[model samples]
Target: MNQENNIVTRLGLCQRIEQLPQVDIGHYPTPLEPCPRLSEALGGPRIYIKREDCSGVAFGGNKIRQLTFTIGEAIHQNADTIVHGATTQSNHCRQAAAVAAQLGLKCYLRLSRDHKSLVQGNLLLDHLAGADVELVDAPFGPELDLVKYALADKLRSDGLRPYVIAAPQSTALAAVAFSWCIAEIHKQQQEMGIEADLIYAGSAGGTQAGLILGSKALGMKLQPVGVAPIYWEDKIDRIRQAANNAAKLLNLDFQIADDEISNTDAYIGQAYGVLTPECIQALKIVAQMEGIFLDPVYTSKAFAGLIDHIRKGKISSDQTVIFLHTGGTPALFAYNQELTDVPI
Candidate 1:
């Protein structure tokens, strides 16, 4: 619609979000820092990094944004424990554990046995945050979610109220949280006197969903490109559903269509959590050029895709782009063997 209408719509969405149960966890309006060196190196668009890594939670990451609502819902339900599951190096679990500790609730993380032998990265932080960590036989997606559900049920049997962060309701809340993140970015973009042409992030679901929903809601022209770090057959559908679910939650009239979602599975490499050569190079370049660290598993892969697009002339120099750094720098320590061979 018109500019005035767009502003009113965004404000209404924010009002609806504020009415929902939420906890104050992450540092808000994370700095939208310019990446001039990175832009120069690519010889591409003016680039900025949305410092979600500087979110000021445990070690900070995108999960902190989602956890504010997830954990808040847990507290609202009078949950004494929070149950979550993912890969061993899961940034979400690490942040969840920290938020749980901050809110004085017990946290149980049932991570897949992938990389279970090493306690270097997120798993180490999970423990440090006092979460009861368990390495399970399940894989990182649906299988791990089932394990979390069972754990939640068992907790209830023990007369303890437990909230599963991966539940459908909680995931929807996460999408709503990220939609608010879009609002923050829009305000920051206005302050900086430039509108971003594209926003890039590593996404399997909620983050991208929120980006799409938020853009549609605000009538912003920028496109959010989600570079998948993991392969999922229903990923696009999942994102669409999440956005729609979030819209419903906010009592919004619009829906996210399949055509509105932009994502790519090309950068995922061999599989989830498996680092590729491109990822290593991207990580090293960003670190050396901008003094920014991207985790091996997620952001590195997405940034690699962005770099490739710039090199291929897919993204023009005149455009402004924002790379969402969904922090997992701690995971860098976990990949010591893989990263040791790569030159700086």
Candidate 2:
């Protein structure tokens, strides 16, 4: 069958899911495996991990899933240049550059000046991708919108079709991709003879939204728990809405109700980007026990929450807990000082 027809029928299951217009960029069905050691250490139910880190395209991460659809849309829209803004070490920027390179489109990254010196991991890859980096001096609070408007205006005025990859603050397409991930998790779990009781991940809001909708659609009883590394009370709820919206866009009947949306804010320590002691400890434990590397910004902080929940007995000893390894190992190199004495 032709690619168009495959997308239309949503056939080939993994190859084409739900009529998605995606550019084949990242490897699919990222390994979902049982973490025997980590699970045993927690003394809770069985533990599993969705290894998105090994997604196998451009350093791999959860972002690639979303970019498949997003980049395709950009190509479909005839975008010749891709523009995005983020912190110095932005995974989205890295992933966007990889996709743009695959599609032979020009890529430009607008980086915030606040943390430029701490460039490592994804930040290094961002440079390796040879993306035209624009430094913005605007502070973290006011810089985002300023950069957005500036880039959009410049792109429009120059007659260049530029596509901006949505930032962590914007859930537009991120929520959609994660919803697909959640659906896949349900299938993989049933095949393994395991029923997941709870799902945990580091999220800005979009990833959690997708997981919630996907879980609901699968009719799975598992709870989607998002550990926020940033303090945004209503932020995750907005992602839930976006996830439901994405489902609706796909002609699926999924409800993202208030009760179904949930998360814990305990993991957000110090501030948004800074690492904390709990996050540092969680990173080391996961790496040592499971050989999984989580960045301080996202997965590490979220994992801390998972560890706390296990210790507090909020999650029973009989339930299965699955941690979504969103794959920000690139960010590890940037925090060498925090996680010193060994290579991140």
Candidate 3:
């Protein structure tokens, strides 16, 4: 992919993406702003944040991008209800509920119970958006997925059309959505006259998958580094498959190779939704330095990984890095008890 070829391919990519059924949900072309103070504090590479936080719709987040296509498909199918599941504080579920409300569709969210389960943060917003919420015994991922499917079935039995948002097909669509996000980032990079060497985000799935697909498709030299918020043994393989699925949707010619996937589970301390000491420190540091808030469950952990790399001198000072702020600031409120002692 030379410069001319990259330009041509990106144009084609944008066209194909536009061809997909989508709803106007999130604010597009999210700002890629320089984090000068954050970079100076880290004493590392030049840092910028892709503000998916400011992506609009129910306080914004990465899920809004995915939901734009996912719910669009629901509307295309004439779905009357949207079913989704994840952990209690899941930004995905929060955004899903909000999007459903915006489009005048009913939403049912089955959230997995966790130690930090509270009627605050995303859960509060979930209810406020008029989503029928249930906190179940199941854990996030496959177990919770089954619950969502059952709910969809029940909805169908009740003579309603339900669309399961976390279904395999919808997950693939999410990856495609994120690939489009990568295209957005690429355009921003070109306009800024700077190219990122690496892009970091909290990922256990499609968000990272799309990053990989988009970077590969655009022939960008940058690597999409996924800092896992949860441990998944087959995360690498899952990301590859998701990326390939997205590529197929976009009519791209390449498949994502295993070697091309870069993800680390080292930052997921204890378990999913458990805040680590490093994560707490990361939240405080970013807030104090940049006046930006990173949610405890995801972005903070990933940012901790980035900070670890910087302090360990893993990234060169000259390299430009983009931290994808996938938004979950609302979760900050839910973690108030835990964050109470952390000094700024």
Give the number of the best model, judged by lDDT. 1
Off by over 4 Å in 1: 1-8
Better of 1 and 3 by lDDT: 1
TM-scores of all models? Answer: 0.96, 0.90, 0.96
lDDT values of the candidates? 0.88, 0.76, 0.88
Q: Per-residue lDDT of 1-344 in model 3, one digit per residue for the tens? A: 24543532677888988888889999989999999999999998999999999999999999899888888888989999999988888888899999999889999999889876779998899999999999999878788888888989989999999988764676678789888888898888888999999999999788999988888778887789999998888888778888888888888887888998888999999988888999999988999889999999899999999999998888989999999999999999999988887665
lDDT of 1: 0.88
Query: Which parts of model 2 are misplaced by more than 4 Å?
Result: 1-17, 140-143, 167-170, 341-344
lDDT of 2: 0.76
Cα deviation of 43, candidate 1, in Å: 0.5
RMSD score of candidate 1 (Å): 1.6
On residues 1-344, what C-alpha lDDT tens digit does candidate 1 reach at each position? 13443533667778988988889998998999999998998899999999999999998999898888888888888899999988888888899999999989999999888654488888899989999999989977788888998989999999999988874676677789889999898888888888899999999799989888888788887789999998889888889889989988888887888999889999998888888999999999999999999999999999999999999998999999999999999999989889878775
C-alpha RMSD values across all candidates? 1.6, 5.0, 1.5
Off by over 4 Å in 3: 1-8
